[model samples]
Target: MSHGSSPSHLRGLAEVAAASVLWGTGGLAVQLIREHEAMSPVTISAWRMAIAAVVLLVALLAVRRAGELVELARSRPRQLLVVGAGTAAYQGFYFVSVTQVGVAVSTVVSLGLAPVLLTVAEAVRDRRPPAAGRLVVLVAALAGLLMVSVAGHASSTGPAPVAGVLLAIASGTTYALTTAAGGSISKESSPLVLTSGMTLVGAVVLLPCTALVDGPHVTTDAAALAWLAYLGVLTMALAYVLLYSGLRVVAPSTAVTASLVEPVTAAVVAAVVLGESLGPVAVVGILLVLGAVAGLGRPAAAAGPVLPDPDPVRPPTAP
Candidate 1:
């Protein structure tokens, strides 16, 4: 079915788009948090997940879907682990990548690689080649992402670019796994349940690491607390709700591709808020990324859903 003809798909697209835009703010938020709070990326990530988990649990209680979380934990413990572990890995890896290569490059590699990895995974699972048109869209989107990454200036504080790229690639793979698993889990339960489970799991996994590695570095300043709250509430909790809501109708690969808007948003924010300058190439790159997302938003006749199985067998779930 064409996204244009389906109201659900349209809603899904908007939901995903909104989530991506909000997520774009995360890099800046982290930067601000860093300015006020002296903490490791892992510690910040731990706080983000822990706070988001608590918020999600409260939201579930309010909506009376708290049982879904318990049911998922009882029934699909492994998938829950997968989603949660993937989330923790993505955040930790991506944030470290940011420190190593800077936000634009790390964001590019982390967000950019998910769609390609997911698309390839879908093609391999389906035992069929991706449609030529869809492949074109993916290529355009990736090319655009690369343009933005290469054109944007990296922060001077980072380490080797190669290491950062590797870390970002790992972040992308973890994110792809999370997105794929999320789509699968949402099929059997509500988005709220899936998000709650994942957030809790991620919190559980990261909280210890934060305490062990960054025990002496935790910050409790008011400004730091406020930034963490914003990251947890808007970027993590609310963003995942929109993400999973969109996954109900959109393919996981497409959803990640749609989220490429993140780098664009980050670039603009850097320019306007941070007083960073974007050259002509960066402007062109931004347009390409925007174009790629637009192409994905339109109706496509041959595309199919890309959702991983909740089970470890990795079957493609039906949309």
Candidate 2:
């Protein structure tokens, strides 16, 4: 679709914003999965992907978009694989982030700073100025997040496990790469087909990987099962679709930056659900993150180390 041209594109942008909010709630759901479901992080990621795949297939059938979905399956197989692999990498590494750095710290490091990286990636990929106004907002948000993390209460899960922190950074990097990849890919493929097809591929990749590391096991406990269901269906499957759709509407940088809200919400949810504490520093960090978001409006327009390409993808010629 043409950038910000059609009314439909504008509507897609709204969808993307809503999807960001939906993704923000994922950490809370995972927290619930931990307490109620008593599942390990590895198990959580595995089940979330697997279960979501099944549910989405059903949803796809019901929606009757199966024909377009089939075409997606036939087209862009390589790109789809890369996107799926990226998805798997993100899931594997993200859990590690929480494991090493503590959920709050890791969340900020990975999710918090992801927008900045994504903006850089988006800018370079598109060869565009990326709008300087957005960069200023992004910097402010980053500053706020840093302060929040510095003063923020650490999760008892411990200072992000050394391994976990590394994994989280790696995950963040891959996530940024995938955002660029997905954005570019979407210019060719339908968003729905792209989202579902990539997810299906992600599930395939995770199947063996999950087994090699974490075996299949079901908890008979009602709460545990319920939490698992929530993560799988709501967070993994549905949330991903929402995010992919949003990517089509929102610029890769804006989409990625707006998503910083997820980690902030995670911090708040951790406090309420995990009973984690955050002092004045926590507030400051949150503000920094917000500043980062606000800053995006500026730097994005400037010629920088990271901004969209001048001619990202050519629009189709009028008939």
Candidate 3:
């Protein structure tokens, strides 16, 4: 089979898409958790990372891979730190931006910008402009993202739009850089190990911030705890494992673009599960985003350097 049509490549695309869908569920989980507890976003995020790290570490130990995680930390400390800190920084900036500007602006500016940044970075790294087709996909996905995000929260403007936009930019930049760095690292490390270590690092980074922002309150409410567990295990832990595994075969730019599915999935979930109505424009935006991701799945567009699997005998597993 041709490179683009290889099982691994197609599997990678599916893995990334699946991860985005899982991420989409996080919004609902967060909303549910908030309904049951008065926790701030930062505190929730800290809990999410902490829970995911513990779960991942426990899995590693169960699989007799604890030593591998330690080796990863020992050998690639800087890269691991960068990935972990970047993950925490982007989410922190995004949450703060939401409070400062509003969800519509923060979501569009932060989530929408990462794909564009990664595409441009890829072009620069390759010393050639992005293919015309890739550019079209990027534009379509971004337009869809803007429409979906803005339509949902048209009147939800925050107190400081300027600061929010700046924070969103910081979030986007960090997200793009982190994706790039993670993709590179995945070429040499197990996705599970990498995710475990980075999540631990991210939890450590976010704990103090959560303490300062919301006093790090953990809800004893059963429903809230369940939702928090969903956010940590499904969204953070499994989703990231899939993301890193997908990064092994998919280009960083394409992977980020594929993740645009998250907002679309979120919109759909909100509409169906919460009985929130979606306007015609939002429906169209969902179509556009889905179309763009489908376009990216084309062999020509999806083609990328397929790195050697870290463990040929045991392929990266995704939940």
Top candidate by TM-score: 3
Clashes of each: 0, 61, 0
- How does model 2 fare in lDDT? 0.64
User: What digit string (tens of lDDT, one per residue) describes model 3 on residues 1-319?
Assistant: 2325666766888899999999988989998988889899899999999999999999999999898777777777888999999999999999999999998899899888888888777677779887667778888999999899988888999899999999999998999899999997887778898999999999999988876775338778999999999999999999999999999888887888899899899999999999999999899899999998887776555423344445543433322
Q: Candidate 3 lDDT (Cα, whole model)?
A: 0.86
> Per-residue CA lDDT of candidate 1, range 1-319, in tens?
3345366666777788889998888878888988887677788888899999999999999989787678778878888899899989888898778778887788777887898888888889989888877887887777878777777764444777899989999999989988888876766777777888889999999988876664345677898889999999999899998898888777888899888888788888889999989988888888887777777656562134623233322322323
Ranking by TM-score: 3, 1, 2
How does each model score on TM-score?
0.88, 0.79, 0.94
User: Measured by TM-score, how close is model 1 to the native structure?
Assistant: 0.88
Runs in model 2 deviating more than 4 A are: 1-14, 122-131, 155-164, 214-216, 272-278, 287-319
Ranking by lDDT: 3, 1, 2
lDDT of 2 at 229: 80
